[model samples]
Target: MDTTAAVPPATVIPHPSTAQGATPVRHNLVSLRRLFWLRWALLGGQAALLVSCEAVAGVILPYSPLLAIFSLQALFNLLTGLRLRQHTGRGARPGDAELMGQLMVDLTALSAILFFTGGATNPFVSFYLPGLAIAAAILPWRHVVALAFYALACYSLMLIEYVPLNLHNPDNAINYHLAGMWLNFVASATMIAVFVSRLSGVLRQRDAELNLAREQLLRDARVEALNDQAAAVAHEIGTPLATLAVIAGELRADAADPRLGATRVSAYLPDLQTMEQQLELCKSILARLRDDHETAAPQRIDAWLDGYVERWQLRHPHARLEANAIGDAAGLPVEAARVGQILTILLDNAARSQLAAGHEQIPLRLAISLDDHGTPPTLTFRVTDRGLGIPPAQRARLGEAPMASMHGGQGIGVYLAQSAAQQMGGRLAWHDHHEGGTVAELRLPAPAPEPLPAAPPPASPLTTNPR
Candidate 1:
């Protein structure tokens, strides 16, 4: 009765703009992780190359300052790891500015090493490009441009600075440069491939999640609008329904009076009684609308289904329905009213379909079952009608929005039913029955079964006189 209850509150899903605003922070967090490991790999490679140059290439170079730069880079890397751990522990992530600062540090560290080894003449100076590439992949355009300019400044400064590789054989210098280029190519290629591809994957996944949230929010908005309309209509019709009930009561009373005469009284008595029953039913519906906010106690699945089917029969006395309950599982608690509304809509549709297909004589079948073997257990309701099965084109579009159906339905009820199903963490689907009709199935998440009471211990054996 309370349609708004099916739509999730705004607090559950933030606005689209808010989601967009948070994207940068998430992107920065992912970038920082990759940067952390990238720096570690660079440090290890620099150390290995330094050792090889000294032992194998026979190059005499300044080891003191270079080793000091490596030690400082390693220490900074340890601090970066600690920062990441601390932020993550508190359920926070590093921001874009922090990430930019990290890239700047790497650039500075590289320049310091290059300044000592051979400045711009060092073959590994091209490593600056890979760092810039990584920055571009994760950071915004403004941050990427800033990092680019900073790297350019470092390169220019290196060109004018000091420190040259001292080699005994000048002929081997070109060979070393060529070999270093090959190694740089391999390392740079690997770093870019691993980090950029993974970052792209993360970006793709985030986009997918955002899109899904946006669609869900849109659906909820539509449902909320529909609920407002329903509430208004309910309020407006209350007086008219009450008036009709009073009129029906007065008519019945007059029919019972002897002044009406026996023949006339008999003619109208049955119709008057039917009118009274229908008026009571309408009044009950309005009463439910008033108390929609109250949380009704859950009812056992079996009892609720039986009562619902009986009430449905009252609404459609002309259409015959065969209701069957199958399953041994007992005491499966169900949200009675909410589920009843969903099934009521389904049954109404089936009846309409039967009329449209000229099969009103065919008895509609309703089967209810409790399946405990499912992972979380499921309560299922199957409604089968020998009527016009859904068209292929309309199958996918059903319940998405209110559209005019071939069977003369406005489709608002189906949409509400679908939303209600989702709110209950359940599913509603329709398929062609094997017996040549449409079968609508509603699968609801059944509550966990109550534990069985422990058997009482047998009364202690009657006290023996020998004791």
Candidate 2:
């Protein structure tokens, strides 16, 4: 089923900084590399246009100085490429200042070319705008403003003094100027759209990655806090649990004595046994805090779920759980305890919902199926309940944070379950069941075929087996 709900904000992490302006803007090496190639294209175009105007269109210009400026631009481009190639360290990147410097060099070169051809009257004088637009996109506003003023000053200086293009016929000046203006517009528009759009896309991708990192940090912090709280709670309950265990043992000893009536002793024995079992369960859970979770051996999904359901049934005697494991998946390398914990949370929520809706008679069902259609086949544990469906507004925000539920629940379990799912490289999502009520589904990536260890050599018939 498709999950359309947006991920909720990270609310557990405290004191998140929201001041975006405090961070400095720096362009990545990709931008600089692209700008390098783009400069080559512009240089080629300038050369082609210059040759066409002088030879084909019969417009006189100073070839020597123009070629010298062109050579200088090419040399600078070569140096930029060398700089990029030489710098291969982790911090090797074009910063805002370096990029602005490159743009400034291009503008100065353009101004020099224009001074020889037609000064401010040159049609390509407006080319400054495209570069300025790119600067605004990648650099900070201060750099953009400074570049703008510099270009304006250059243009003003050009207007006061320059060589004009000498045409074969003075009457053709208006026609040539109009044609050049059209070409300038086309070139300027292309440059602005191509370069600025590319830079914008990179900026957007960077922002998305930043948000992902921030959310991950928040999740880690919340998980750490929860773990600390759990440890402290476990420590606090240890003494009380030990005291109850001693009291239960004394009651059992008293029940065994003939002084107590046989009928009363028999009746109290079952309750005492149940109390002892629960106490043992609590002690075992507390002991698990020190167990190395990473060393847990892989087991069959069906086998794991069967044992988990039996243990869960002990804790929840009233609510019925019907678990079904489908598919022939072998050796699922998952953290069974964590998965069981998440399922416990889901099952508890389902039972609460059922009780709230007065449908305690209906059994909550969990179907574990292996989806082999996709790469790295997925194991889905879908828990369905015959209870009231979650409200549309609340459904979207269900696992985002702890919220009050109409079913007398704090909703902390669901939030913790979702976080645990994420930690295990899985996801938990809920949708309305087709018939009624809600279905909470957990999908985990299942990599299969953990090979069995090779069998040891058999002992001789006369010798004893070492196994």
Candidate 3:
């Protein structure tokens, strides 16, 4: 059952804006801290690699300058890591300019170490490729291009001027250098192909989800406009309907007067009946507008739906419509009135569209499917119609606001339908029907049954004896 406080008409509240077409792109810097941590680990590996080559392979390499550069990188990483650690969330994220600055520092240090070791001939020169790959993934295209150019300049400078490698045994230098180059190739390829690929996939998925959420928000905003219009229109209609009712009552009184002949009174009888019917229809319309249909208590949803369909059909006599239950329809709990209102809104829109197209009879179908195999059984209600489909211009713009057509139609039905579904922790979606029409689907979380109270405990023997 609906437990919400009553909402006054939307006329008082300013209409919501539906101008946002898409979610803005967000640059995530959560990984920047982790990248710093990785640098520390890689620096440790660099020290070990150098030690293994010297002690195990007995290569005479310059240790002092290389160790100095390594120590500098470790100190920089420690300080940077501590600074960035406090800003783990997006709010504290530094812009791309800051991140690019860090990458440039990393490139400069690597270049200095390479200049001392063997300049362009150093096997670790390939490490620049991984850094470039990371820049391309995280930075804008322009910034990545700049980094590429900077890296190219460093490589060219290294080729012309730098310290040469000390090959103690010139005879084995070719074999050892060749093996180092091969290892570099393997490491670079693995980082670029596997890690870069995974990161790209994650970014794309996040963008897609953001776009979907933005679209849903736009739909809700526009639908709210319909409520505003409905509230206003309902108030305006009261005066005209009252005038018509008074006129009808006067005409009936004149017909019953003795001064009027029996023949004249007979002629007025049929017209009087038609007028009374029209008055009732107007009253019904007003009532629907005033009551947002939240009064239905929790009960078997299928049964409520069955009765609702019968009433809806009577309201639109010329419309050919049918309701069906796809599975076992009984005992599933729901707040029937809200579901009914949502369904009615969808059906009304379809009926009006079909009538506008000059169709002699509007054909529509409401189908309910229930799946109880899972906890909190799910219910899917689909309203299918064979009317002219939604126009392309309005497709993306649907359900955001109350729009009107040149033919004096207020286009708020679908928006109201969607808003109703959202109230029940569900959603409404419009899709193209396979049979050349539109299908509005309402998927709501099934009402959960309340827990039964515990039975009273049996009287204790000692208490019974006191009694």
**Which 10 consecutive residues of model 3 have the lowest summed lDDT?**
458-467
Superposition TM-score, candidate 1 onto the true structure = 0.52
How big is the positional error of residue 298 in model 1, measured in Å on the Cα after superposition? 42
lDDT of 1 by residue, 1-467 (tens): 11121221112445865756566556666778788888888888888877888788777778888889889999998999998888767767787789989999998988888888788988889989888988888788999999999999989988898588888788999998888788879988998889888999999988887887788787886567446535533632443455456657877777687886355556767666666656665656556545644324566654555556666665665677876556543346666666676777777788778877889888888777778887887888888998888886776777777666776566776776787787788878989878777988989887776543322322222111110
In terms of lDDT, model 2 sits at 0.72
lDDT digits (tens) for residues 202-266 of candidate 2: 77876776676678777877677557545433632443465567667877777677876365556
Model 1: CA > 4 A from native: 1-27, 219-229, 256-467
Superposition error at 126 for model 3 (Å): 2.6
Please identify which of the two predictions, 1 or 3, would achieve the higher TM-score against the true structure.
1
Tens digits of per-residue lDDT for model 3, 75-143: 888877765765544346656877788788889888998898889988778789898998888889988
Query: How many residue pairs clash in model 3?
Result: 3
lDDT of each: 0.72, 0.72, 0.64
- Quote each prediction's TM-score: 0.52, 0.51, 0.50
Q: Where does candidate 3 stray beyond 4 Å?
A: 1-27, 218-222, 225-229, 232-236, 245-467
Worst 10 residues of 1 by lDDT: 458-467
